[model samples]
Every structure is written in C-alpha cells, then in structure tokens.
Target chain A: MPELLILVPFTGALLCFLFPGHIRDVIGLLCAVLTFVASIILTGNIYQNGPIRLNLGGWKEPLGIGMCVDGLSVLFIFLTGIVGLLVSLYSVSFFSKANNQSLAKHFWPLWLFLWGSLNSIFFVSDIFNAYVVMELISISAAALAALSGTNASLIAALRYFLLAMAGSMAFLLGVGFLYAQTGTLDMYLLGAVTDGGPLMAMALGLMTVGLIMKTALFPFHFWLPPAHGEAPAPVSAVLSALVIKGSFYLLLRIWCTVFQDTTASPQTATLLGLLGLTGVIWGSYQAIIQNRLKLIIAYSSVGQVGYLFLLFPLVFITLDPAWKIEAWTACVFQTISHGLAKAALFLAAGNLIHATGTENLKSMRNIADRLPMTTFTLALAGVSLMGLPPSGGFVAKWMLLQSILASGQWWLAAAPILGGLLTAAYIFRILSQAFVSDDQISCCGHVSFVMEKSALLLAIFSILIGFRSKEVIFLLSEQVYFVIQGGIIP
Target chain B: MTTLLIYAFTSIILFSIGLFGLVSHPNLIRKIVSLNIMGGGAFLFLISLAYHGRSPDIDPVPQAMVLTGIVVTISATAFALCLTRRIREKTGQCLLEHCPDKPET
Candidate 1:
C-alpha cells in the first residue's frame, strides 16, 4: 500500500505524458482519487494496528531501503491527499477559464511528479532516501514554479532552485556525517547509535539550517513571495500548502524522534522560537503592505509558517509530560489548519484574480457583489487564518496557549495573539476592498463554479477540523506515546 | 581518526567557499556554479566516508549514495542553466535586480 502511494502518481505522470491531450486531466484526476483513497486506507490500517515498516526488495534493515508510516506520516499523507485532490480539481477549471490548453497539458505531469515526491518523502525511513526525495521535490517544484514562463516567475524559480540545491546539499552532508558515525542509514537504527558528540551536533546544525531554508522560515524566505505570486494559482497553492511542509516534517521527525536523546540546547530552542516570532511579526507586516492579493497571501504564508517553529522551544524545554502532548498536538493541528486555510485562500484569491483580471487588491473593490461565492470563500479562509472562534486555527491557538501557560511561559503567549491581530488587519484589508460599493469596480471574466467550490470546500474543511480536535489529538497521542514507549530500534 | 578529521576540515573549507560564492555572486551562472561546488563538497564528504582502513574495504552505501547524488546534481544544474538562459533572453541581464538600477524600470 505504501509503495502504491508512490507508484500511482508516478505511473499516472508517465501516462499523462504518453496519453493524448484530452485525457491528461482525466488521468490526473484519477491519480489524485486513487492516491487519496490509498492514503485513507493506509492511515486507517496504521491506526487500527500500528506503524508499518517495509524493507524494499526483501532486504533486511541497514542493508535495504525502507518505508515507514507512523501516525505522523499518516497525518501528512492525508493532508497531501486532501490538498492534492482540491488542486487537481481546481486545475481542470482554472486552465479552461484561461484557455491555456498547452500550459494545462504541461502542468499535469510536473504536478503528479511533485505529488509522488512528497509522498515518497513522508514515507521514507532512510536518511539517504530523505535527501533523494528532497531533491526530487525541489526539482519538480522549481519546474512547476517556472511553468508560467514569465520573466519574474522564471527568475524566481531559478533563485528557488539554486537555494533549494544548496539546502539539500547541506542536508546530504548531514546524512553523510550520520552514516559515517553510525554506519547505518535507517533512522530507527541511527537513533540508537547516535550520541551527543561533536559530529552529531554539527550534523544537526547543518540539517536544521538546510531544512529551515527549504521550509522558507523567516530570514531565508526571500524567494517565496515572488515564486508563489507569479506562478499559476494552483501551483502556488500546492507549493505553499505542501512542499514547504515536506522539509518541515523532516526536521520535526529528526528532532522529535531520531535525535530525541540529543535534544538541542535550551539556547538553540530559544533562538529558534525567537526566529519564529520574528517571522510572525515581520511576515504579517509585509503582508499588510502588499498591493497584490496573491503576494499578500504569499507573505501571510511566511507568517503562518512561524507558528510551526513555536513548538520547537516549547517541546525542547517543557519537562512536564502532559505539556509534551499539548505542544505536539498544537504543532500538528496548526500545520493542518494552516495548510487547508492557505490552500483555500490561494484558490479563492485565484478566482478573484480570474474574475477581475487583476491581482491588485484595489481593483478588487466591490467584487463581493460580483462574485459572492469567491468572496465568501476568501472570508471563510480568512477567518481560519486569523484564528477566530470555532475554526481549526483557533483550536490550534487555544492548544498552543494552554501549553504555553502550562509551561509558565506567559510572555510567549502574546506572540500568537499579536500575530492573530495582525492577521486580522491584513484579512480585513482584503475583505474591505471586496465590500466597498464602487460603481466602477466590475468583474471582467467568468470564474467557473468548480473552482469556487473547490476553494470553498477546503475552507469548510478547515473550519470543520476544529470540531474533530479530539480525534486529531488522539491520533497524534498514539504516536507520541509510541515514541515514549521506546518502540523503535528494537 | 586524524585522516577523517582532515577530510572533514577539507570538506568544510570547500563548502564555505561555495557558500561564500553563492552569497556574494550576483550573476546567476556563478550562483549555479557555486551551488554545484557546494554539492561537490557534500558528495566528497559522503564518498570519503566509504573509505575504510584499506583501499578495497569501502562501504557500498555511501558510494551508491554519491552516485545518486551526482545524478541529482547534474539534473538540477541543467535545470538551473535552462532558467538562466531564459532569464538572459527575457531580460538581457543575468544579475538579480537587488541593486539600485532595477530591471523593471
């Protein structure tokens, strides 16, 4: 089933390339549905029993490459499925509305390749496999970013590609060091062999810096806004929603599981938390000042990504056992909430841009009456982004605050609230443009109902997830406890 | 252990040079080349780990990893070069627009 998770999209990508023009979208949709169903089944099976670890080609551990899916991997895989399905559906209508059939044809293969690469990353248990998949993800993403073929977009893609390569190289160096020290590539084995030596510390530093660069956290996020803003909307949605999370998931897995014994110093965790705090404040300020709607959301992603790092310091320092679960759940839930909300925001922003034939927020004035559905989608997604009541983002914030307070870190709690206020400022900025009664403001083009519906559905799910917090927390706890039980390296 | 430390130091120096070039260079080709150099240093580090006490006693895993790394590096460099060419053709400048003389104007 895990192999099928990778094979389905890869085969579909090949079929997409080989098949005729008319059937490419069909193949893409079929692959999305197949992968989504397979991921659900994989998650369910894992939940019912336990994590699955498979040695490829019948080769045993330390010799053969392996794939493993714990509760964490399942959570990410399920996210990829949901976001992939919505993006695939949105693409079908998005291209048709633009009447760019040729570009649409080129999009399917690259998109599938990226989707498969992401699945491979989440499932791989070997450090070397992680590096390879990271490269695969970077290459496919760079190509996808360049699909628009505009000067700005291409330049952005080039910069993104180069930085990503540098990041991956650093990561591979870390892998090399780990292999040298432990003589094993499997993460489970490495955990037992690794010690808090100079080599391990160096490897951790190199890998963390590399993964954070790829994740586009704060200072290294210079390339993200342009790449995201200039790309076709569906591509931007996937890049912002999933690709960035790939490296982040790696960092989380390594730090939380493999290097749990070699936890970074409290100072390092504090530094990371400070950087994240900077990202929230800085990214939100930039987002508020952006004229282009997509650029605003792109910058908003930089801010939202900050929330993910807040867990580092909390998880690293908290001695209370209960706070550990709270921090973990908050981190994972925050990831899911932001993923759905941001995807919805990008897709809806795409619709608005499509309808108005402009990305400038000013021209979007009075578009609420013109395209009410898209407007509603944007508002729904915005509510989640701002962490308002009865939304997934709100629940995440609540859990984060609870943990922060439990840890007696009252000062740290102010960051999220302030971030939320700034988020509201920017969201309302866009919403006000939509609500204004400007007679000259008019939507120039038709946005397909399918496109609007896809964004709306994702936004609804973003809110709906708030109600399912118990189940989400339960799934996260299952794996958290498993790690505590010393189940790996057996 | 001394030899390993020397090799590690050499890789670090190589990596730092590449990192310096990547940060300091304005030209896209230079940046790409810097990235390749950085990758070379990392691959060197990986391959060096395969070396054991004797010449024949080499680990197969790091060698295999280096081979895969080389393939990935080639493709990435190729893609970056293609984008460089496109940027050159589209704007007639390989330098990024971070300077005072912005390209858009």
Candidate 2:
C-alpha cells in the first residue's frame, strides 16, 4: 500500500507526459482519485494492524531503502490525498480556460511528481532518502511556481529554487556528518547509535537550519510571499497547502526521534519557539498590510506556521508525559487546520481574482453580492484562521494553549492569543470588503461552479475536522508511544 | 588523519566562500554558480568522509551518495539557468533585486 501511494502518481505523471490535452486531464484526475483511495486504505490498515514498514525491492534496512508509515506519516499522507484530489478537481477546471491551456501541459506532470515525492518523504526511513526526496519536491514545486510565467513568478521561482538548493546542500552535509559519525543512513539506527557529541550537535544544527530555511520560518520567509502569491491559483493552493508541510514533517520526525535525546537541547527548542512566536506576530502584521488578496493569504501562512514550531518548546520543556503528547498532537492539529484553511483561502482568492480580473483587495468591494459562494468560503476559512469556535484551527490553538498553561510557559501563551487577534485583523480586512457597497463592481469573468464548490468543500472540511479531533489525537498518541518505546528500530 | 583534516577544512572553506558569494551577489547567474559551489563543497565533504578510515578499502556509501548528489545538482543548476534565461528575455533583468514587486494581474 505504501508503494502504491508512490507508484500511482509517478506512473500517472509519466502517462500525462505521453498524452495531450483532454486525455492528460482525465489521467491526472484518475491518478489523484486512485492515490486518495490507496491512502485511505493505507491509513485504515495502519489503524487496524499498527504501523507498516516496507523494505523496497525485498532488501533489508541499512542496505536498501525502507518505507514506513506510522500514525504521524499516515495523517500527512491522508492530508496530501485529500488536498491533492480536490486541487486536482480544481485544476481540471482551472486550466480549461483559454489563457491557461499552455500551463495545463506542464501542471499535470509536475504536480503528480510533487505528489509522489511528498508521499515518499513521509514514508522514507533514512536521512539520505529524505534529502533526495526533498530535492525532488523543491525542483517540482519551483517549476510549478513558475508556471504562471509572469516576471514576478519567474523571479520568485528562481529565488525559491536557489534558497532551497542551498538548504538541501546544508541538509546533505548534515546527512554526511551523521553518516560519518554513526556509519548508518537509517534513521532508527542513527537514533540507537548516536550520543551527545560534537558531531551529532553539528549535524543537528545544520539539518535544523536547512529544514527551517525550507519551511520558511520567520527569518527565512522572503521568498514565500512572492512565490506563493504569484503562482497560478491551483499551484498556489498546493504549494501553500502541502509543499511546505513536507519539510516540516521531516523536521518534526527527525527532532522527535533521532535527535530527541542526543542533541535536542532545551535551549535550542526554546530558541525555535521564540522564532516561531516572532513569525506569528510578524507574518500576521505583514498580512494585514498587504494590498493583494493572495499576498495576504501567503503572509498568513507564515503566521500559522509559527504555531507549529511551538510544539518543539512545549514538548521539550515539559516534564509531564501527558503534556508532551498534548503538545505533539496540538502541533499536528495546527499543521492540518492551517493547511486546509490556507488552501481554501488561496483558492477563494483565486476565484476572486479570476472574477474581478484584478488582484487588488480594494477592488473586491461588493464581492458578497457578486460571488456569494466564494465569499462564504472565504469567511468560513477565515473563521478557522482566526481560531474561532468549532473550527480545526480553534481546536489546535485550544490544545496548544492548554499545554502551554499546563507546562507553566506563560510567556509562550502570548503567541496564540496575540497571533489569533492579528489573524482576525487580517481575515476581517479581507472579509470586510464584502460588505462595502461600491458602484463600480467590475467583475470581468465567470467562475465555473466546480471551482467555487471545490474551494467551498475544502473550507467546510477545515471546520468539520474540528468536530472530529478525537481520532486524530488518538492516532498521534499511539505513534508517540511507539517512539517512546523505541519499537521502530526493527 | 592529517589528510582527512585537510580535506574537511577545505570543504568548509569552500562552503563558506560559496555562501558569501550567494549572499553578496545579486546577479542570477552568479547566484546559480554559488549554489553549485556550495553543492560542490558538500559533495567534497561527503567524499572525504568516505576515506576517513585506515582500511584497505574505502567506504562505498558516501561515494554513491556523492554521485547521486552531483546528478541532482546538475539538474537543479540546469533548471535555474533556464529560469534565469527566461527572466532576462522577458524583463531584461539579470539581478534578482531589480525585479519589480507589483502584484500579478
């Protein structure tokens, strides 16, 4: 099943390259649906039986590549599946328009390749494999970002590509250092063998910095706004929603497992948390000031991402095991909720841009009357971003706040509270334009019903997940136990 | 042992130089070359690690990794070059800092 998760998208990507026009669209959609189904079955299998590990080509670990799916990875796979399918649906209509026909030719292949790489990142059990898969993701995602062919997008893609390449090099050097010290490429083996030595510390520092750069944590986020804001809508949705999460998931996994005991000092974790807090405030402030709708959403991603880094500090500083689990689950919740909300917001912004033929937020005055479905989608997604009640973002922030309070990190509590307010500020900034009555409502194009509904469904799912947090929490706790027991080394 | 130390120091210096060039230069082509230099430093470090032991045979793993790394780096550099060419053609700009910040329509 894990192999199926990778194989389907890759094969579909190859088929997409072979076919042309309508046939390629059908193949891309079919591949997406197949990948989603495989992910569902894979998740269920893990739920019923436990985590599954596959030795590629019947080769044993420490020799050949290994793919493993624990509770954490399965959750990510499921996310990619859900977002990939809807985005695929959205893209089918998105690229069918007259102007986007040239883009459709490249979008299918690159997107499927990206999906395959994302799945592989979640499944790989070795650091070197993670590096390789990350490179694959960076190249494909950069290509997708440049699909719009605008000067801004082209420049953004170049900037993004260069930074990501540098980050990957740092990551590779870290991998080299780890392999030098431990002589093992497998993550579990490295965890078992490593001690709190200078080599381990160096490797940890290098890898963390590399991953942070790739994740676009506050200080390194210069390329994100332009790249994400300038991409075509579906591509923007995917890049904002899923691509960044890929590196983040790897960072979480490596920090918790291989570096958990060796060199993951409390000070370093706290430093990460501090950066995250600043990102929340800084990114939200930037979002509030952006004139363009997509740029606003892009900056909001930087803010929301700050919440994920809070997990490191909360988990590291707390002594109680229960609080640690809460922090872990909270971070994952934040990731998923933010991903869905951000994706929905971008797609909605896309629709608004499409309708008005403008990216300016002020021109969207009276959008409430022009495009009710999309406006509602934006509002619902806004509720999630604001961490309001009965939304996934609310659940994540609530759990995060509880864990922060329980751990006596009173200072850390400011981020979610203050960040939420700032978030609401920007969210309302966009939403407020809906109510303003302007005579010159210049809606130039028609948005297909399918495009609006897909975005709406994604927004609805972001809220719906809030009501069903128990299962996700349960799955995460199970994985946490597996990590604690050191049961995965086999 | 001395050889290993020399190689390691050389790799680090190369990496730092590339990083400096990457940060100081705004020209797209120079940035691309700096990225490759950085990659070269990393690959060299990996190669040096493969020879850290006093055995008759060198470690094959890092060697394999370096080869794969080189392949990935080549493809990435090629892509960067393509984007650079397009940017130059479309807007007649070669420096990243010179690109305009207007929102796409």
Candidate 3:
C-alpha cells in the first residue's frame, strides 16, 4: 500500500507527461483521487493494525530500502492527499483559461511528481532516502513556482533551488557523519546504536540546520514569500500548504525517533522555541504590512510554521507524559488546520486575483458586493486562521495553551496569543475591505464555480476537522507512545 | 585513519569554500557552480567514509549513495542552467538583484 501511494502519483506523472491537452487533466485528477483513496485505506490499515513497515524488493532493512507508515506519517499523507486533490481540482479550471494554456502543459507533470515525492518523504525510513526525496521535492516545487514564466518568479525559483540544494548537501553530509558513527543508515537502527557522543551531536546539528533551512523557519525564510507569493494561485496553494510541511515532517520524525535519546536537551528545544517565537511575531507583522494578497498569505505561513516548533520546547521541557502528548497533538493539529486554511485562503486569493485582475489588496475594496461566495470563503478560512471557536486552528492553539500552562511555561504562551491577535489584525484587514463601499471596483474576469467551491470545501474542512478531533488525537497518541517510550522497532 | 581524516578535512574545506562562494557571488551561473562544488564536497566526505574500515572489501552503500547523489546533482545543475538561460532570454539579466520586480498582478 505504501508502494502504491508512491507509485500511483509517479505513474500518473509519467502518463500526464505523455498525454496532451484535456487528456492530461483527466489523468491528473484520476491519479489524485486514486492517491487519496490509497492514503485513506493506508491510514485505516494502520489504525486497525499497528504501524507497518515495507522492505522494497523483498530485501531486509540495512540492505534494502524501507518504507514505514505510522500514525504520524499517515496523518501527513492524509493531508497531502486532501490538499493535493483540491488543488488539482482548482488547477483544472485555473489552467483552462486562455492565458494559462502554456503553464497547464507543464503543471500536471511537475505537480504529480511533487505529490509522489512528498509521499515518499513521509514514508521514508532512512536519512539517505530522505535526502534524495527532498531534492526531488525541491526541484519539482521550484519548477512549479516558475511555471508562470515571469522574471520575478524565475528569480524566486532560482533562489529557492539554490538554497534547497545547499540544504540538501548539508543533510547528505550529516547522513555521512551518522553512517560513520553508527555504521547504519536506517533511522531506527541508528537510534538504537547511537550513544549521544560528539559525533552524534554534530550529525544532529547538521541535520537539524539543513531541515530547518528547508522548512523555512524564521531567520531562514527569505526564499519562501517570493516563491510562494509569485507563483500562480493553485501553485501557491500547494507550495504554501504542503511543500514546507514535507521538510517539517522529516524534522519532527528525526527528532522524535532518531534523536529522541541523543541530544534532545531542553536547552536545544528551547532554542528552537525561541526561533519559532520570533518567526510567529515577525512573520505575522510582515503579513499585516504586505500590499499584495498572496504575499500576505505566504508570510503568514512563516508565522504558522513558528507555531509548530513550540511543540519541541513544550514536549521536551515537561516530563509529564500527558502534556507531552498534548503538545504533540497540538502541533499536528496546527499543521493540518494551517494547511487547509492557508490553501483555502490562497485559492480564494486566486479567485480574487482572477476576478479583479490584480494581486494588490487595495483593488479588492467592496469585492464582497460582487463575489459574496469568495468573500465568505476568505472569511471562513480567516476564522480558522484567527483561531476562532469551532475551528481547527482554535483547537490547536487552545491545546497548545493548555500544554504551555500545564507545563508551567507561562511565558511561552505569549507567542500563540500575540500571534493570534496579529493574525486577526491581518485577517480583519482583508475582511474589512469587503465591507467598504467602493463604487469603482474593477472586476475584469470571471471566477468559475468549481474554483470558488473547491476553495470553499477546503475552508469548510478546516472547520469541520475541529469537531472531529477525537480520532486524530487518538491516532497521534498511539504513535507518541512509540516515540516517547524509546521502543525501537525490530 | 590518518588518510581518512585528511580526506575528511579536505572535504570540509571544499564545502566551506563552496558555501563561501555561494554566499559571496552574485552571478547565477557561479552560484550553480558553487552548489555543485558543495555537492562534490559532500560526496567526497561520503566516499571517504566508505574507506573508513581497514577491511579489504569496502562498504558499497556509501558508494551507491554517492552514485545516486551524482545523478541528482547533475539534474539539478542542468535545471539551474536552463533557468539561467531562460532568465537571460526573458529579462536580459543574469543576476537575481538586477532582474526587475514583477509587476503586481
């Protein structure tokens, strides 16, 4: 099933490349749906049975490539499946327009390739494979960012590619250091054998820095806003929603499993939390000031990413197992909710751009009068982003606050609360434009029903998941045991 | 062991040089070349690790990984070069800073 998860999208990419015109669209959508189904089934299988591991070509681990699907990986896979499908749906109409025909030709293949690589990243069991898959993701994502073929986008893609390449090299070098220390490449094997020596510390530092760079955490996020903001809407949606999460997932996995015992000091985790806190404040502040709609959403991603890192400090500082799980689930919830809401926001921004023929937020004044559905979608997504009641973002932040307070780390709570206020400031800033009565609103293009509704579906899902948080919490705790207990799978 | 340490030190020096070049240079082609140099440094480190043990037969895993790494590096370099060409053709500029800001959509 894991193999199928990776194979289907790759096969679809190949087929999409072979076909042309409308045929590629059909193939792309079909493959997306298939991948989604496979992921659902895979998640169900893991839920029923324990976590499953697959050895490729009938070979054993340490010699053959291994793929593992646990609660954590399945959660991410489910996210990619959900967001990838909706974005693919949006792209169908997005590219069908007269002006986007050239971009459509390259979009399906690159997108499917990216989806395949994201799945592989989540499923990978070794550091070397993670490096390879990450490189694939960087290449495909950079290509997609440049699909608009504009000068700014090309420059953004180049910057993104160069930085990602440097990050990947650093990661590979870390893998070499780990192999030299443990004589094994498998994550679980290395974890069991590692003794928290100087070599292990060096490997951890190198790997963490590399993944942090790729994830675009604060202080290293220079490449993200342009690459995400300047890309076409659907492209921005996927890049913002999924690509950075790919690296974050790897970072979380390695810290939880491979480095769980080695050098996971409270000081190091607190250092991460500090950076994340800065990211939250800085990114939100930047978002509040951005004139372009997409750039606002892109910068917010930098802030939302900050929230994910708070989990490290909260979990690592508290010896209480319950709070550890609370912190863990909070981070995962934040990731999912942010993914959905941010994607919805970008897609709705795309619709606005399509309708008004501009990316500037000022041009959207009084847009609520003309495009009520899109305005509502943006507001609904904004509700989640603001961490309002009965939304996924609220649940995440609430739990995060609970864990922070429970751990007696009251100071750490400032980031979420302040970040939330800043988020509301920006979200309302956009929403207020809807109410302003501008007589000269220039809507030059049409937004297709499918495009608007797809964005709406994601926004609605972001809220709906808040109500059904039990299962996700259950799934996450099951894996938290495996992670915290230091049980190396044999 | 001494030989391994020497090779590892050389690889680190190469990596530092590449990183320096990458940060210091403004030319896109030069940046790409610097990235390849960084990859070379990493691959060299991995290759030297394959010879870490005194046994007659070397560990083949790092060698295999190096081979795969080379393939990935070539493709990325090729893609970067292609983008550079496209940027040159479209904007008549090779440096990232010189390219005009994208007009607001």
Candidate 4:
C-alpha cells in the first residue's frame, strides 16, 4: 500500500502521457478517486492496527529507501486525496469554459501526477526518498506554473525553477551532512544516532535553509509573487494553496521528530518564531497595497505562514518538552486552515477574473453584482482568513495564543492580535470591493455553479475544521508526542 | 584539513556570487543558470563538509545527496525551459517582457 501510493499516480501519469487525448479527464478522475479510496482504507487499516513500515526491494531501513504511514503522514495523504479531487474537477470545467480542450488534455495528467508526488512526500521515511519526492513535486509544480503560456509567466517560472534548485541543493547538502556523521539517510535511523554537535549543526543549517526557501520564507521569497501572479488563476490557486505546504510539512515533521533534541533551546526556537512573525507583518503589509488581487493573495500567504512558526518558542516553554504537541498542533491547524481558505480565495478570484477579464483591484471595486457567487466565495474564505468567530482560523489562532499566554510570553501575544487585525484589513479591502454597486462596471462573462460551488466547499471547510480540533489532535498524536527525546530511534 | 575547508570556502563564495547574479541579471536563462551554480556550490560545500580522513572513507551520504540534488535541478530546469520556450514562441519578444502592461495599453 505504501509503494502503491507512489505507484498509482506515477503509472497514471505515464499512461496519460502515452495514451491519446481521448478519455483523459475520465482517466484523471479515476486516478484521484482510486487514490482517495486507497488512502481511506489505509487510514482505517492503520488505526485498527499499527504503522505500516515498508522497505523498497526488501531492503532494511538504514540500507534502502523506506515509507511509513504514521498518523501525520496519513492525515496529509487524506488532504492530498481531497484537494487533488477538487482541483481535478475544477480544472475540467475551468478549461472547458475557456474552450481550450487541448490544454485541458495536457493539464489533467500532469496535475494528477503532481498529486501523486505530494502524497508520497508525506509517507516517505527515508531522507533520500523525501528528497526525490520533493524534487518530483517541485518539477511538476514548475510545469503547472509555466502552463499559462505567457512570456512573463515563463520567465517567472524560469526564475522560480532556479531559486527552487538552490533551495533543494541546500537541503540535499544537509542530508549529506547528516550522512557524514550518521552514515544513514533514514530519518528513523538518524534519530537514535544524532547529537547536538558539528555534523548535526551543519545538517540542521542545510535542511532548514532548503525548507525555508521552499516555504518562501521572507528574504528568500523572491520567486513567489511573479510565478504565482503570472500563472493561470487555477494554477496560481494550487501553487499558493497546496504545493508550498509540502516543504513546510517536511520542515515541521523534521523539526518535531529529528531535530527536536538539538533544537530544544527555547531561545533558538523563539528567534525562529520571530522570523515567522516578521514574514506575517511584511507579507500582510505588502498584500494590502497590491493593485492586483492575485498578487495580494500571494503576498498574504507569506504573512500567514509566519504565524505558524510562532508556535515554536512556546513548544517547549515549560522546559518539560511534553507540550511540543500543542505547538505542533497549533502550527498544523493554522497551516490546514490557511491552505483551504487561500485555495478557495484564489479559485474564487480566478472565477471573478475569468468573468470580468481583469484582476485589477480598481475594477473589482464596482463589480460585485456581476460576480455574485465569486463574491460570496471570497467573503466566506475571508471570514476564515481574518480568524474571526465560527471559523477554523479563529480556533487555530486561539490555540496558539492560549499556549503563548500559558507560557507567560505575553509579548508574543501581540503577533496573532496584530497579525489578525492586519489580515482583516486586507481581507476587508477585497471584501468591500464585493459590495460596490456601480453601473460603470463593465464585466465580461458569467461563472457557473460547479466552479463557484467547489470554491465555497473548501472555504466552508476552512471554517468548520475548528470544530474538529480535538479529533484532529487525537488523530495526529499516535506516532509520538511531536518532540520525542527518550524513545527508540528507528 | 585545509584542503576540504578551502573547497568549502570556494563553494560558499560561488553560492554568494550566484545569489548576486540572480538578483542582478534580468535574463531568464541567465537567472536559471545562476541558480544551478548556487546549487552546485552548495553541493560542493556539503561534500567538503563530509570530507574525512580519506576519499574512500568519506561519507557516502553527501555523495548520495549531491546525486539527488543534480537530478532535481535538472528536472526543474527542464520544466522551466519548456515554459520559457513556450513564452518565446508566443510573444516573439523575450528581452523586454514585462507584466505591468497586461490587460491594456
């Protein structure tokens, strides 16, 4: 089953490429449905029994690549299943309306292939395997981003591809550093072998720099705005919404599981957390001022990611370290909520742009009546983005605040409060545009129910996920309490 | 000891140079090339860090990592190349490409 998760989409991708244009959508849909069903079964099987550890070619952990279906990996696989399905379906109508069937034919297979790569990244237990899967995700994503077929889009994709290479290389070097000391690339094996020394330091530096670059963390984030802004709206939606999360997911996984012992210094975590806080402020500030709606959302994504890192300092505030679970949970919840909300916002924005034939903020200012459904989608998503009542973003932010308050980091309290306010300001800037009723607004076309409805569903999930906090927490807790110190390594 | 450190220092300098090129160069392909150089430098630095008592005794992990890095870099460059070619084919102008003039004159 572990191997099949890697197998299914890869085979599907090849078949899609080799086969003719006929039935491509059907093939893509089947691949997503089957992958989702397989994931659900795997989840039930794991919950009923234990982790399924698979070694490739019958090789052992330290010798060959391995895959593990722990609680975290399973949850992410499920997200891939869900998000992949919606994006695939949305792509069907999205391209159809544009009358670009040939483009649609090519898109379905590549997108499904990307879906497969993302799911496998979550399950890989070996560092080298993780590297390979990250590469797969990055390549597929670069292709998808470049599909817009514009000069600027291609150049932007080109720029992003180079920067992404630099980041990936740094990550690989970090793996090399670890191998130098531990002589193994299996994450589980490295756990028991590592100590907070020179090799570990080098490895940590390499890994964090690579993942942060992938995440588009502040200073290294030059590639994001152009790549996203230049891509087709749906492609931009997924790139901003889902693909970037893969690296951050790995960052969180490694920070909690592998680097926990070494990175336990609260002061260091606090400094990292501060870096995140700055991303939030800087991202939001730029987001509010952007004239282009899509660019604004892209920059806002940078700011929102910063809030997740704030949980690090509080992860071990008690010095007991048992509370790392809360820190990890807060961060993950923020990630999931923002991902769902932002995807919906971008999709809705795409719909609006498609209908109006422009993404200018000034034009959107008087075009609400023309795009009723898209407006509703953006508003609902904005509710979650602003971290207000009855929404998952609210609960996620509340959880982080509770932990910071509990840890007596009263100063850290300003981050979520001010960040949320900044978020609201930008969200409202877009939202207020929805209510403008000027007769001077000349829009282009009409958006359909399927496109608008899919956006709404993801947006609503962003709000409702907060209600499942306890269950989600329980689901993620089975493997280890995020920061495992005194346990067997592999 | 000094040989490995020197290699590592050279890699660091190369990476910094690539970073400078990335920010300074407006050409798309040049930017892509610089990025690969930076990646190469990082790989070199890692291999240097893993350099030990002898070449034969050196860490296999860094070597494995460098190999994977090379593959990923190639794949990314391939996709970006595809996109760049498509852009050049469509617009017929690459040097003066800018997005600000989109949607209108």
DockQ of the candidate models in sequence: 0.56, 0.69, 0.66, 0.46
lDDT of 1 by residue, A142-242 (tens): 99998988778888888888889889988988988777777888887777764677778878888999999999899999999988988889999999999
Ranking by lDDT: 3, 2, 1, 4
Candidate 2: C-alpha RMSD to true structure equals 1.7
| Candidate 2: Cα lDDT at A54 | 83
State the lDDT of candidate 3 residue by residue for A385-406, as single tens digits: 9899999999999999999999
lDDT scores for all predictions?
Answer: 0.86, 0.90, 0.90, 0.75
Off-target runs (Cα >4 Å) in candidate 3 are A485-490
> Model 4, stretches more than 4 Å misplaced?
A47-50, A263-267, A316-323, A365-371, A442-444, A481-490, B1-26, B42-68, B82-100, B103-105
Candidate 2's C-alpha runs over 4 A off are: A480-490, B101-105
RMSD of 4: 3.1
Fnat: each model in turn = 0.70, 0.79, 0.74, 0.62
CAPRI grade, predicted model 1: medium
Tens-digit lDDT track of model 4 for B9-79? 79878878877877688776776677778877877876775667756666666666677677767767776
